[model samples]
Target: MSDLAKDAASMAKGSAGLRGAPHHTAKPLHDFKAASHDLSALGALGSLLKATGDIRDGMNTLSALTESLSEEWNAEAKLLGEVSDAFDLLDVLLSAAARAKKG
Candidate 1:
């Protein structure tokens, strides 16, 4: 009798009728496949947009740096032209002084 009681107890413990996790029901295969495809598509689109935004940011930074460098180069060129003019003036003054000393 005790053996029968033990068997009954074991069966009850293992049975789904007792308190435990709920059993899962299967859905249609097409429904699962469609939802999975939609999720994958959305994931790919998100990655593409993120990459585009990164590229746009990099281009903007490059453009700003190029503009900045161009401005510096212009300023340097202007200053160098001024220095060259000063040197030409100095040469003319030296030539006049030499002529005065000789005459």
Candidate 2:
């Protein structure tokens, strides 16, 4: 092909490529991206709230157990049980923080 013809063909190809791009036609990709980001934030927040609620419930259980054990003079057993409860709560808190940070 002649140089002029080659130039015209290349320009046509470039224009065709641009036409296929979503940005050139204002596709809904921008809105979808925003919605996806919002959903992710909501999910993270939900996870954190759930984890905190779980920890609070567990603490309440531990406190009640401790009070009962104290009346029976079972301090050693209560200490072990409370240690397990503490670890479980820590696990929830750390998992929640990690999931939130990932988002």
Candidate 3:
């Protein structure tokens, strides 16, 4: 009776159910074929192309902005030079007036 009980306990420990073994299906070939069809390389190339185009566009925009800023700076510098010349003329006139008043 103890020998039969040991056999029954061993069978129960090894089996998924009281009498049945575990069942598992194999991976289908079609699943492997689908997994092998990767487009990550093409996706990376596409992203690289888009980034290059964007960088080119940004460089163009920066060049235009730099040129515009240069023009604005030149205009401001010219205005400052004109104001300086006018101040010089005013100083000369004031000095002449002072000399005439002393005479």
Which candidate number has the best TM-score?
Answer: 1
Q: Kindly report which residue stretches of model 2 are placed more than 4 angstroms away from their true locations once superposed.
A: 23-103
| Candidate 1: worst-modelled 10 consecutive residues by lDDT | 17-26
TM-score of 1: 0.52
Which residue pairs in candidate 1 have backbone atoms (N, alpha carbon, C) closer than 3 angstroms, thus clashing? none
Pick by lDDT: 1 or 3, better one: 1
- Candidate 3 Cα misplacement greater than 4 A, ranges: 1-49
Tens digits of lDDT, candidate 2, 1-103: 4343444455555544443443432335335433433434446665776764554465556555644544444444344455545555666676788899999
lDDT at residue 90 of model 3 (Cα atoms): 64
Clashing pairs in 3: none
Q: What TM-score does structure 3 among the candidates reach?
A: 0.51
Give candidate 2's total backbone clashes: 0
Q: What overall lDDT goes with each candidate model?
A: 0.49, 0.51, 0.48
> Of the pair 1 and 2, which is ahead by lDDT?
2
- Per-residue lDDT over 3-98 for candidate 1, one digit per residue giving the tens place of the 0 to 100 score: 434444444444323222212212333344335334444456657767645544655565556556555655655555555455556666767888
Clashing pairs in 2: none
The TM-scores, one per candidate, come to: 0.52, 0.29, 0.51
lDDT of 1 at 92: 67
